[model samples]
Target: MPQFELANWLPQVAWLILTFGVMYLVVRAALPKVEAVKLSRAKVISDDLGHADTAKTNAQSVEAAFQAALVAARTTATKVTGDTKTTAAADAAARLKEIDAALAAKADAAQATLAKSQAKSLKSLEAVATDVTGDMVERLTGRRPAADAAASAVAQASA
Candidate 1:
């Protein structure tokens, strides 16, 4: 009997009123709270995502700074190496120049000594020649060469 009565239009009207009243009360009471919870969760997730993005940007900035420092260090090292090489080359050149100067001075001194020895040897040879010519003239005709003729003969022999 109750099932047959529920299927009738009068029972249908009663069910409609009950369902509408309950649904309106539930929506009025709970819908705002649910919406508020959803909006709060969305804001929290957005904030967390923003923090992650900021962290990523900060890491990239740190990497860029590290790379710049490395480049600076490499440039400084290269400059130092170039400077050292240039300094070494200059020092070597200076040492070579000093050595050349020393060698030139020694060569000049040796040349001067040789020239002095040659002059002394020439004087001795001239004296011996004069003595031999005087001895030959005395043996041949009993006369000696004059001083001027002896001087001229020594000059011609040197030439």
Candidate 2:
């Protein structure tokens, strides 16, 4: 019944207006700060995203550079290996040629020695054959053959 009373209406209206005005002032005062905070957070998040993008791009470029360096190293290694193989083959060929030359020289010397020994042996065999023939002729006919004749006969038989 106090709510319905005509004398309480103006006071109730005044209280409602006061309460609404205070609430409006409070909300109006806080709205800009809230909006500023929200804007600051949005800016920070954007900056962080930009930094992440830059880092990703840098990582990609670094990876590309590393791959390029690795490829270059491999190419250099292959070239060096090929060059080494060529050099080694050349060295081996040179050494083999030297050995062959030495062996040929040795063989030629051995051949010369063998020829000298054969000549000496032939001279000794001729002297021995001449002596045997003279002794055989002396025993068979009671007369010795001349040294020159026996030597000539042996030479003719050999020819």
> Which one wins on lDDT?
2
> Which regions of candidate 1 are displaced past 4 Å?
1-7, 107-159
Candidate 2 residue spans exceeding 4 A from truth: 1-18, 125-159
The 10-residue segment of model 1 with minimum total lDDT is 2-11
Q: What is the total number of backbone clashes in candidate 2?
A: 0
Per-prediction TM-score to the true structure, in the order listed: 0.60, 0.62
What are the per-residue Cα lDDT tens digits for candidate 2 across 43-92? 99999999999999999999999999999999999999999999999999
Residue 111 lDDT (model 1): 90
Report the lDDT of model 1 for residue 95: 97
The pairs that clash in candidate 2 are none
Overall lDDT per candidate, in order of appearance: 0.89, 0.94
RMSD of each: 5.8, 4.7
Residue 113 of model 1 has an lDDT of 93
- Per-residue CA lDDT of candidate 1, range 1-159, in tens? 775665587877899999999999999999999999999999999999999999999999999999999999999999999999999999999999999999999999999998898888888878777777667767887888876677677778778
